[model samples]
Target: MSGSTHTVTNQPPPLVGYDVFAADRVLTEGLERHLDPGPLAETRAELTVLGRAAGSAQAREWGRLANVQPPGLRTHDPSGHRIDEVDFHPAWHRLVGKAVSAGLTAAWARPAGHLRRAAAFLVWSQVEAGHLCPVSMTHAAVPALRADPGLAALWEPRLTSTVYDFGLRPASQKAGVLLGTAMTEKQGGSDVHALTTRAEALAEDGTYTLTGHKWFCSAPMSDGFLVLAQADAGPTCFLVPRVHEDGRRNPFAIQRLKDTLGNRSNASGEVEFDGTWARRVGDEGRGVRTLAGTVAAARLDCVLGSAALMRQAVAQAVHHCTYREAFGARLVDQPLMRTVLADLAVESEAATVLALRLAAACDGAADGDERERAFLRLAVPAAKYWVTKRCTPLVAEALECLGGNGYVEESVLPRLLREAPLNSLWAGPGNVQALDVLRAVQREPGAFDAFLLEVGKARGADHRLDAAVRGLLGELGDLDAVEARARRLVERIALVLQGSLLVRYAPAEVADAFCAARLGGDGGAAFGTLPHTLGLAGIVERARPVE
Candidate 1:
């Protein structure tokens, strides 16, 4: 009985067996605010189911196993037959299959599809992020393929199908399909115009043969790839299937799988395409324009993915603090710890609200609202720039709240921290997003007007936000050194937009703290620097995951 040395006392229980979607007040609130009444009920019911499943111990184990047992590259069969396949753990398939069946990739077909899928994505991604790569790519590819109706008709239904059909086969043979992208070359990066990959016309049926090496081919195990290559006219988009309609393997080789810092459950490969068969998606020389929808949709996913990580990090931090004790007091009850948790909660809330707002804009655009389309031209990049940038630091700070325990892989905070920067770098780097915002403001008059109208609605509702908006306007007015000052200007634009949303929808305590800390600059550089009189405890409690 005296051998009790190993008994733990102050440790918190594992944060599982709770509704991930329903527990997130901010995410649920965003759903209510964005979705119509009829759809809101059904969406909530569906998401609640996913949330519960995501929160289960079984699902958590699946996520852990998927990451630990990262996918492997199987370049050949036992007889040395060329079979470029990436071998994933069964857990990986389960996570991805659940996502696919939950309608994550079927968003393009439903009413308020973007909002519904964004909410589902944010919640399920909390379970595992890696599998969502194909999920997101399949979702984004819908619009890009639509540029060619024949291609859309051929692939759209499979890509959006709820059945998670996994394997290399002809698109015609699959009930569901995942799409990957091989656009960035070794030298070009985001500058697709600099790509040297050449595509030669093969037949009059819009078929081409591509020969190039893609530096980063995301979700390599996908059924097909939306590749960008130089055609006779110029750079154009093409769809390259993994196999021919007759079950013959395409000339696609997965050279090597990227050893990424995190999201190891997913396979990103350096692929080679020598005489790769492809069908052109749109007019040659207008590849960038044709794939603009894909880029934008992916950018939005960057924000949503980052928000999911941030939210999960904060939830873990707050949940830890609620139980772990030091010096005869729970960490959540300590003044400074509560302040830190509140600061993190505020950040998570702002990100959730802003991300859903962007999703709502997409929904509007789908409903034929040109104004929302214009608004997205500016808002998506700006939010993508700032929110994803904040995710890394916020997650790192959240991990710190657990002290040494958070540093270990068992806590999941380390995983969250590692996954944090992936979103920022995925669609394009921060600089690209900032410059995109600049381009939108300069070229699209309606975009800037739409942005201003968005922020202007909350004018005088919160003085600090108003001042920040004015400051943003003045910064926009001055074009001197604008290119050099793009990051600064974009940060202003993003913060003002977040402030506007918080002022309108967030609780008084949350909005006030956000305006004071982010807009009015009444706080210092650290998370615990918010003014002492704010409702820090209440904010922390709000973010606590219900179990």
Candidate 2:
């Protein structure tokens, strides 16, 4: 006992036993405002239970185990027969099962589904983000399958089921199913039109055989995949099942699982499709159109996931600062540290408000609202670009708040940092999302107008927001260098939209700080650079997670 010169002391106790959902004032209030009172009550109760589970020691262990023990690919049987399968850690399956049981994948089939699912996804992702790969793919596949009523009729029920069936088995044998996608070839990342994978008609009944390679196939062990292949007519979408109708494995060969920077718990693979049987999802030449809704849905999930990362990162930082003191006071109460935490809180809250607003738009769109549908056309890409872009920096700064401890694997901050860049890269990259924003503005003028209409609601509420909107409108009018300035233009669009949302619903202090620092440039270039005189204490307190 006397061997060491000093004993360990002054460290804060581990952060556990807190309700993630309740601690998140922004999410809870947003859910209350967006959902009907009755549904809000019930959904809040459900999320509270989930939040407790997510923050529990057991769940934390699951997250640690999942990442430490990544998925492994099993390419063949011992007897030399090809049996392509990706095996996951038991913890991954536990997380996925919890997510499925929470109705994260059945958003389209439930009441107030999008709002519920969005909140659930945000909460669950904070626990383990890798398992969300299949969860999001399964959720997004609904719209793509709906392009063909017969296919939708056959698979929709299974996709929406709450059961988690894990294995490479026939769809008929499972109570539910998960989905994945293989859209890009090696030559084309976001440019799906450049895909060279070809599909040949196998029968007059619209079945086909695909022969090509997919450069990136996420969740390789998924029950089915929505793939893109060049057909006689043009590039088309197809549903490729893992097991054929005759109960035999499809001719799908997994080349190897990718070694990704993050998301280690999920398996992403390069696959070769040799005579892989598939059925056309929509019209032969309407692949892009058929997948439009699916992509938009997945993009929304990206926003939600990023927001979750930011929230958790900030929460961890605040929690650490609250208990760890330095010099003469708690770190959280230190003036400069308070300013930084408050600034991060502002960013996190703004992201949460915008994400939930998008979820509300999804709900409204599903209810046959034309304006909501149009708003989504512009909002999805903008939110995806901005929210995901903010995550990396936010997490990095938050990790710094914990000093060296945050950089180590023992803390979740490192994982959050690794996961941050992924969302921006997923769905599409920054340039892709920016270009998509421009495309929507030019091709779907009505959608852009709908977006402006949504933002216009809070015009007179805040002068800073009003000025930002006016500037954005002026920028939109000039299309000469639009493509060259797409990212800048998209950033303004996203900021203005987020500013508008904050002004309308956020508490006065939070909204004012966001508009000043984000819109009016009242802050420095880095995090924690908010004005000294601002209500930094109040904002930081709001973001702090308590037991």
Candidate 3:
């Protein structure tokens, strides 16, 4: 028999071998409440399959291995010729292949595509997030490419393909392809229009040769990139490919790979394009306008990514507490522990509800619903700002729930904690998002009206929500100092939206707990600070993952 000291006791079983999709009451319920998206049976079935893979022990191991052995940069071939490449572990390829084959990138032309794709992305990201950088770039590239008919005609089918074409090849030869985006340079981070990379027009047919340095290029291994560069007319967008049609290397030189804190499995490179052949994406001086759709889609992905991390962290915490024992009782049964879990659960549900609502709006907007498009103008950035900002703290609290065990590298919480801030930092940091919302509120009155109309549907549902709406309106009535208070206003806007969503869609207990704790001023600053009067155990139980 194993010795008592060596035996493992008082440990929670691994949270694996479960249907991540089916177990998520909030996600499933919100899915239905939002759009009744494309035949529920079919959509649910497909997501369930992906969910099973995400929750499997095998998939979890893939996540671990991929992170442990991050991708490597190859700047030159053995001889002397420059052949910049990024080499990823087998697990990375598998994860990317799984996501791509499941139609994660084919969301543009299908029924209820955005909602379904967003749901799938939310689930798979819990497994491994780094590889999704390329996946997201490829998916978002569809709209930017569509700005040019010839470019769209050539690249659209390849981008939306379910096949995971994993190597550099001519676009015409590949069954599928991946893409990247490079808007930020060393001198200009979010100031994309201040680019110095020059693009010289070669012929009238959208061809150009770009020459300058690109400070941050996402997914360097991608076959092509939608980059920003200065043209004769001003700043403009260009499509730069890794391999030309005649099988000649483009003059794109990889300066170095970025040493990021997390998301190490994906390669972020600083590249130099010297007389590099590219095709103009849109007319000069319109790079930002051409990239509008791409940026919006990316911001929405950040929301989903943040929400997915929160759900996984909460699931892990609840699963741990459900089995842990202290003071002669199950940890989850303890009053204080239950309160914390419930609080975390409430926050997670709010994020998921808001994210799903946004995805449904994407579907609507795709179907030519002008109202949904306008709503996205304001909601996407506000949600991105608040939800992503909340992820780091929520993950940290979830880790604390596991006590000393959580601090160790063996636990997934450490990895999750490292991954937490990435969404907030990426796709324009919190300030950028808040300021973008402020600009929208100033220039796009229709967007604000649409947002008000959406929130108005839940006007009489909850007193807290109603009061919140009133407070927001009063605050927005004056813009004399709005620039200085943009973040505060945006946070309130996101909270009210979440509150409205819960009031109309979530379970009574969840909505009540959320309104009471978040909007009703009954909670503290940290997780687990919800009022003790609520049904704590029931709320935690609803969020627990099955094994």
Q: What lDDT score goes with residue 58 in model 3? A: 92
lDDT of 3 by residue, 227-304 (tens): 999887888888999999998988888888999898877889999988999999988878888889999999999999
lDDT of all the models against the reference?
0.93, 0.92, 0.90
| Candidate 2 lDDT, 1-547, residue by residue in tens | 5588888877877777778888888999999899888998899899999999988988988998999999998898999999988888899899999999899999999877998999999898989798899999999999999999999988998899999988877887888999999998899888888989999998568799999999999889999999999998899999999997678999999999999999888889999999999999999989999999999999999999999999999999999999898997999999999999999999999999999999999999999999999999999999999999999999999999999999988879999899999999888999999999999999999999998898999979999889988888898899887899999999999999999898889888999999999999898889988888888899999998884
Question: Model 2: number of clashes?
Answer: 1
Residue pairs with colliding backbones in model 3 are 340-528
Q: On a 0 to 100 scale, what is the lDDT of residue 17 in model 2?
A: 79
- Listed per model in order, the count of residue pairs whose N, CA or C atoms clash below 3 Å is 0, 1, 1
Q: Which residue runs of candidate 3 sit more than 4 Å off their true CA positions?
A: 1-4, 35-38
Worst 10 residues of 2 by lDDT: 1-10
Error of 2 at 384 (Å): 0.3
lDDT measured at residue 341 in model 2 versus the true structure, 0 to 100:
96
Question: Taking the tens digit of each residue's C-alpha lDDT, what string does model 1 give over 48-107?
Answer: 999999999999999999999999999999999999999899999999999999999998
Candidates by lDDT, descending order: 1, 2, 3
Estimate the TM-score of every prediction. Answer: 0.99, 0.98, 0.98
